[model samples]
Target chain A: MNEQEAAALFGALSNDDRLRVIRALVRAGPDGLAAGEIAEAIGASPSRASFHLSTLSEAGFVHAERQARSLRYRVDFDRIGALMRFLLEECCAGHPDLRSCCGS
Target chain B: MNEQEAAALFGALSNDDRLRVIRALVRAGPDGLAAGEIAEAIGASPSRASFHLSTLSEAGFVHAERQARSLRYRVDFDRIGALMRFLLEECCAGHPDLRSCCGS
Candidate 1:
């Protein structure tokens, strides 16, 4: 991904609450989770969860879909992989010798 | 990595200049590049590179080794992996169907 988008993704992750929210989503997995469920999992108020989810959606790290009235949020692996690749490209300064360890 | 360190790493990456600095370092590889060299590569002033490098090292995303007078910077893959994993765990919030795409 381009640097600007990368910055947005990073910015979305930079906050403590948001990171926790994403981690909760990761644990919740392919099923993803509803807004209230995620907030409760991360110990956030409903409003706070909504705010962080908006940030994640804006950054393209997570996608939100409305299931009934509840919003189901899921991780966006494409963007996650893009980030991993961007940071790990030559990764650790070309420890190309160590690339075997990276794919895990 | 724990959430706190993850937050710092994300914060360091949130800026555009720092991301460029890292991309340059990633490109430069295990040889990593000297401070002056990295600055020139990313079109930043030497001092700016120094500040940015300090943030990266502090956040544990990059490492700096002194080669006589100049310090060389390299990506820290372990931390990068940690961040990627932290975000990708059940990843995309549980799309086991998509596991194939993640390890790449």
Candidate 2:
């Protein structure tokens, strides 16, 4: 990803509530969690949770699917992985020893 | 890193100037670059670069050290790697195929 895309992804994750939402979804695993569960887990209002989730989704950090009536959200692993790779893309260039900085 | 630490680090990276500064420093590699060079490379004033550099350093994304008169700055790869790991800690919690989310 380019700097602007990475910046946008980081911008989506720079909030406490959004981070909490991501962690909760990560813990929830493949089944994911409904909006109310996420709101309750993160101690955020329903509307606030919805807003943050939408931001995360728009940034490709989270995926939302309609399950029955409520929408379920799950962390978008591939997108997140791409983000991690973007952050460490060059990773000290060809200095193999410097791989520690790239997280090995 | 914990949620707060990760949040702070992401907060530091959320700005465009800081992101450019990081890309410049990453390209500079081990020798690093003086504050003035970073400022020029990123099209930022010395003071502005210094402020963002300080923020990145405080968040453990960059390291600064004095060499002669000017301080040189470099990306702290290990710290950055740790941050990446923190973001992908669970990685689908044992679903091997889901490893894609962790940036495999």
Write candidate 2's Cα lDDT for A1-104 as tens digits: 77777888888888878888987887897899999999999999999999999999999988889989999998877787677666665433434433454334
Write out the backbone clash pairs for model 1. Answer: A29-B93, A29-B94, A30-B93, A30-B94, A30-B95, A93-B29, A93-B30
The per-model lDDT (C-alpha) reads 0.74, 0.77
| Weakest 10 consecutive residues of candidate 1 chain B by summed lDDT | B90-99
Query: Top TM-score: which candidate number?
Result: 2
DockQ of each candidate, alpha-carbon based? 0.47, 0.50
lDDT of 1 by residue, B1-104 (tens): 66767777788888888888877776776798899998898788989988988998888878888899988888776676667665555224434433345444
Tell me candidate 1's TM-score on chain B.
Answer: 0.83
Best candidate according to DockQ = 2
The local lDDT score (0 to 100) that residue B56 gets in candidate 1 is 84
Per-prediction interface RMSD? 3.5, 3.2
Estimate how well candidate 1 is docked, as a DockQ score: 0.47
